[model samples]
Target: MTHISKYRMKSRVEKRIKDNFLRSILSGGSARRQAILGELLTQTEKIMLAKRLAMIVMLENDFSYYRISKTLKVSTSTLKRLHRHILAGSYRQILTSLTGNRADAIIRFLEKILEFRMPPIAGPGRWKFLDERRK
Candidate 1:
């Protein structure tokens, strides 16, 4: 019967997925990460995904205003604003100011605006805004 055949096919595909997931977990990718990804694939919002990806590209690099603008296909002014935001804003605030909505400067200048005074954490990529939080 067609129903029986479909069930068998689904079972086979699920087995392969389970096997691959087991291997990934054994390699220490984190059980949470594996579980979250394994919960059936789904679609994402294009704009939000693009914004988050752009944020990642900017954060992961020692990028200039012009460089980030070019890479993210946004205007130079917009990139400047994001730079300003990173310095002046908290994590939640930065998330809000995404998409060319905010000024660019060394993070120190932005920190001055926010009156955010915090001690620095030691380590690579420790505190996000170095120019602001670091000596």
Candidate 2:
């Protein structure tokens, strides 16, 4: 859970300032970026960021809401919001960055990680047949 200050800011930062900050972060080398993020984000914040990215990746892979919810322990409402963002094409750049050129390989790997075992087929009739044959 993130804690936001109750006090509102008197003024919002300009878009250009925000864009410049983001650009500076993105322009760094991978190690520098990792170091900056490590210093900037709290552990909980990092977990939240990872989960959101995972949710987006899983959604793109066509995973069911139930599966994603069960696996990630996130609520359906969160998935719904992300889905809306996805439909709006809000995540295209983020998705591309997350998956890179090996999208198929990455998705396949995520699919394997997300896979769950289904219960074997069973019924009262089958159980009864087995009991009779044993007798």
Candidate 3:
């Protein structure tokens, strides 16, 4: 999870900075936005953001908690928190905009990457251990 400092900024100062930051991001083209994010976020932070987006997409699809927890390797607590956010309409606009194929593609891609495991060795039985059902 992303961390915030113990120190707090004044509400007005924070709001002004947040508005400017959002304006900077929203004014950019897709490539520029990607570049800015790539420069600003660490790999772990990027992965966390991606997984959160994937989790939101999965939740919108009405996937069961067990399947989502298993597939995303996220805690039930995290899912529960996000689920509450969803119920409160935190993701309303984004979910509405990403309906149908786009949402499905994101889910499929997330599953593909998260479920993948490297082969243990280069042999006939190399891929056997990669079978998740065996575990």
Candidate 4:
């Protein structure tokens, strides 16, 4: 395809992705979302997307490239590309919001499981070791 045609096709696909049906399906509860994703995406595609999200979260948590790569089993080049996207600010806000919500949900779930509220971390520096850990 020509460059202009490719751009037009991309835009059309973007529009389709943003359509109400897809939005509503994705916005459903976890089970429904999982079902839809299972039907729509191949297992490999789902795994890759999960890994990408994990990388985004790890990057947001101040994890280093080496640590993320080692833990996620992804290459340095992939991490660099993700870092560029994060730095470019296209996915930063959505990634941060999604990660924050997920973190809160995990904390709540853990609290429910343990039958007690977990103490908050003392300070920002408390999590500095996360960079050193394998994850």
Give the per-residue Cα lDDT of candidate 1 at 5: 40
| Candidate 2 residue pairs in backbone clash | none
| Candidate 1 TM-score versus the reference | 0.30
Residue 64, model 3, lDDT: 81
Give the runs in model 4 whose Cα sits over 4 Å from its true position. Answer: 1-14, 17-21, 99-101, 104-135
> Tens digits of per-residue lDDT for model 2 on 2-121?
997887654555566677778867986999889888888899999898889878888988889998898888999999999999999998888777666566765666666565344347
Residue 122: error of model 1 in Å? 53
- In terms of lDDT, model 4 sits at 0.71
Better of 3 and 4 by TM-score: 3
lDDT by residue (1-135, candidate 3, tens digit) is 678899999999999999988888778699998888888899989989877888899888788888889887899899999999999979888889888899989978867766777886577887776565467
Worst 10 residues of 4 by lDDT: 1-10
Tell me the lDDT of model 1 at 40.
Answer: 34
Clashing residue pairs, backbone N/CA/C < 3 A, model 1: 80-103, 80-104, 81-102, 81-103
Regions more than 4 Å wrong, model 1: 1-45, 56-60, 92-135
Q: Which candidate number would show the highest TM-score if scored against the true structure? A: 3
Worst 10 residues of 1 by lDDT: 99-108
Tens-digit lDDT track of model 1 for 1-135: 112243445778889988997676667557766565556333444444554446534553455666555544667776666566666653554445543433233333433534654546676655666565456
> 3 or 4: which has the higher lDDT?
3
Please list the C-alpha lDDT of all candidates, in the order they appear.
0.53, 0.80, 0.85, 0.71
Would you list the clashing residue pairs of candidate 3?
A: none
